[model samples]
Target: MPATGRENHTAPKAVYIHIPFCTNKCFYCDFNSYVLKDQPVMDYLRALDREMELTVRETPPGEIKTIFVGGGTPTVLNPQEMEFFLNSVKKNFPNWAEDIEFTMEANPGTTDRDKLAVMKAGGVNRVSFGVQAFQNELLSGIGRIHNTDDVYRSLENARNAGLDNLSIDLMFGLPNQTVEMLDYSVSKALELGLTHYSIYSLKVEENTLFHTLFQKNQLPLPSEEDELKMYQLLMDRMQAAGYKQYEISNFAKPGFESRHNMTYWRNEDYYGLGAGAHGYVNRRRHMNIKGVNPYVEAAMQKLPRLEQFSVPEAEAMEDFVMVGLRMLDGIRSADFAAQFGVSLEETFGRELHKMLSSGLLEEHEDRGGYRLTGKGVVFGNEVFAEFIGVLT
Candidate 1:
């Protein structure tokens, strides 16, 4: 058995493909992506195809359950390029589950009806749009190109093209954003009645424009008190709308959780393809080269790995608790023991006891494992931080 408790020979069921081109970079995004103009799109696609071919030959996949195509903006491809890319995916990883949940990320103004039709025809059943906010002023402040109208039009196009399993991403704690503004965004989002919503708070990541503004004290971010109020209101409103908070930042109707994302939260294995993608399989992890042309050149001859290494068992166990606890279901004792050949109590006894004593964690009522108390959810970072360096 693998360190992850799955059979070492069992093929990975999830795959992540990256498309590095977007129309423009958002102010707060630190993802490995580039603007579309002058990029060698076709050459990059062919390189990706080669990578997939090499990948499957080395680690032949089983019935693929999920494939997530993320990008600077995957939907930026024209129909022809989109068709070619999707066909390459089908050709290389042909054995898909009957109920596979293939998802592609898109920018609102980029996905037209024609492009969406091609996406649906090529086995993409889900589309997650980057509609960061409902307010145009906030959107502009964040360097997003789409207006509120583009969001509606894009959704209409997606539905019209037979892609109904839709999700939109919203952000709070943006510059000059008020609690009232967040409320308005959530209300407008709920009015769409989509199956999933991913609401995130702004983080001033290094290398992003927001981070520079923050350092210069030019970023007009909301106060910490107001941010807390916004989160409280968000949780209350999402629950009131009957959406389940399956993960910290994700809400879904029952049975509509993002299965692709679940693979990550559950600490399972997946293939990561394309420039700057990361993959973990058989207790080993690898990150692809980040630059597009450099990646293309590298993939032409061999696997374009920037770095790959085996994860130490102790570090892996720490990761298991940190990511698994992000989900509302939390980590179970049985699952933990299965992966590491040790009970959770035996491994994380002191940390668990400390959190439980602090009223931050409680044994799940219906489930056997421990979960966060309401207070813990708001302070989840603190709980997760407790586990770090405990094992190592």
Candidate 2:
């Protein structure tokens, strides 16, 4: 796949590439990732390169505005492997926006100075580190390999490599965590003065170590009230530090909002490549094969799809509302009308009236849309749940 002059401006503008190799799996993670030892790393990268070649031939990309490389810790790749993978991206998706937001996810201890330099030279301008907790005990409790010192060292490496758009993820509601502990974590995180922060509450997903411990009542998670307090404290602290809550769990300095994630909230199209990645484009969604060997074998001959389906119109409309409500700015009524050829009220009048009456939603003061109220923000799952079966 060489650079081409023809540009399909309406094609998918966002790309999500998954690297499924991790040094160790976290206790709470159920994502399709595996331990890196003895894994066929080069074979998988070559297969991903083939997938990209086939993907753009099927749906030629526009001037790509955002490209996100997610993982099992993408920074785990050595400098040589990193260079090859990034070169494959540039070859397939040749037309890039001048100010494209190319981001890679990293684990704190995994990113060294030399690897960070390779990432920057490969056109990665942003990095998001998975610094789940500030406390060493909590970090170990969650099976994270990195400590507080590693977080600072990784951030320094990123900056030294000339990649300054940085973000760190902090978790609340961890096993044996307290509100004060969360407050301390947020305070330490804010002290870094990074460009963005993502604060997430822990969810004990099935098949994870946490879930197994939880089933036996072994995980000492914070109580609901303490978790709620943690959420409130983090929000207040982030606001005081001048970071805007652009989405439910994401906060950023002005103009530092994650454009790649915004593509999902806006219900736009994107290419999902690599093992176990799910992509949405042209109203169709597909998930690639989950196993490394299977994905590599399949991609050499075809798209390596494990499953594919076209989203029904009714479900697409419901998705538009569900994901759009995640952003603080909310969904514009005109955008919905333009996409569906019907007013938002005409399609979801009953549901809208119910939520509006309950005070979970409010009309946008300066825009033609509706946004979540404070109460709605806290109980977002309940609000999003209302849209699911209503469309079906």
Candidate 3:
């Protein structure tokens, strides 16, 4: 069970809705998604609606501050299905905040003008296009269905449909990629004049094509030194273009940062609906089952097929430090104290002292909180690992 005596507090401020259907899974992808052929799309949407209904029944919907519809590819759904899903969301959670940040993930090839207009009508104000690269060769190398033309057309379609707040995702260190390729990707993305960007370095996880290539020493990724240089170049270019690096991998025009992701980094409570979605509520963490059919069946019975566990206070403190440090502004000591009812130093003074001594972290003189220095951000995982269980 989750941490007891914490359930009577206010409801969550954010909600993450996962759509698990995709036209085709990319080669280097590991997210919970299924191919569209013969999949029960409508059934899954109904199940998702049921899950939302049950969640609101358990905890009345608070002022929803952010809602992100991510997934296999939200744009894969037909217009009617999209309408059904979005309607379910509005019907179940009617008390959305005035400035709610509603974002939906789209694929370049899947979205059309009509579909985007429907999305805009459904209260979606932001669209994130999955444009892994600007070159067709790189797109094919990564098994993405869309080419450069598709990306340009999609962005234009989004603008034509009146959805202006757009973001594009780019990847670095891809197979057969070079520094020049990365530069081209970023340059082309900027040319689109997007409001936000998420640039991620490829990680070779198990069951991914990249993982197989890595095991065989067949990957054509750039050298580590080159990769680091690429990262620096991206940061410099984005900053020069006036985009703020709110988090390590995300950049946005000032005041256009992603609110849904901020809810996660802030460790605030949120409802995660759909297969393989994770939720943090009432100081407890739960993960829904990853399979689509099982999730649907379980949700149909108004039961979350989830594994629930309470996050220990010590672990929570460590998590707070770890996640909060990911932001450029770093953790707020006052917020930590308020959440834990204990001074920040009282909880992790020794760990902070050790990290400070090692030059991996520095305390802000004016802010009076710890933040990662320039060198610290590169070794952030190392520093966070040290604080994980140091107090316990």
Candidate number achieving the greatest TM-score relative to the actual structure:
1
For model 1, residues 142-217, the per-residue Cα lDDT tens digits are: 9999999999999999999999999999999999999999999999999999999999999999999999999999
Across residues 1-392, which tens digit of lDDT does each residue of candidate 3 receive? 22333444689989999999998878889999999889889999999999999989987878999999989998999999999999999999999899999999999999998899889999999999999888899888888999999998999999999989999999988878888888988888888788899998888788887788889998788889888888888888899999999888899999999989998888889999899998888788888888888888899997565797988877777788999888877888877876777788887888889989998889887777988877787777888788766656
Candidate 3: lDDT of 235? Answer: 87
Candidate 3, which segments miss by more than 4 Å at Cα?
1-8
| Window of ten residues with lowest summed lDDT in model 3 | 1-10
What TM-scores do the predictions have? Answer: 0.98, 0.97, 0.96
Per-residue error for 46 in candidate 3, Å, reads: 0.4
lDDT of each: 0.95, 0.93, 0.87
- List the candidate 1 regions with Cα displacement exceeding 4 Å: 1-7
Q: Please report how far candidate 3 places residue 243 from its true position, in Å.
A: 1.0
Cand. 1 TM to true fold: 0.98
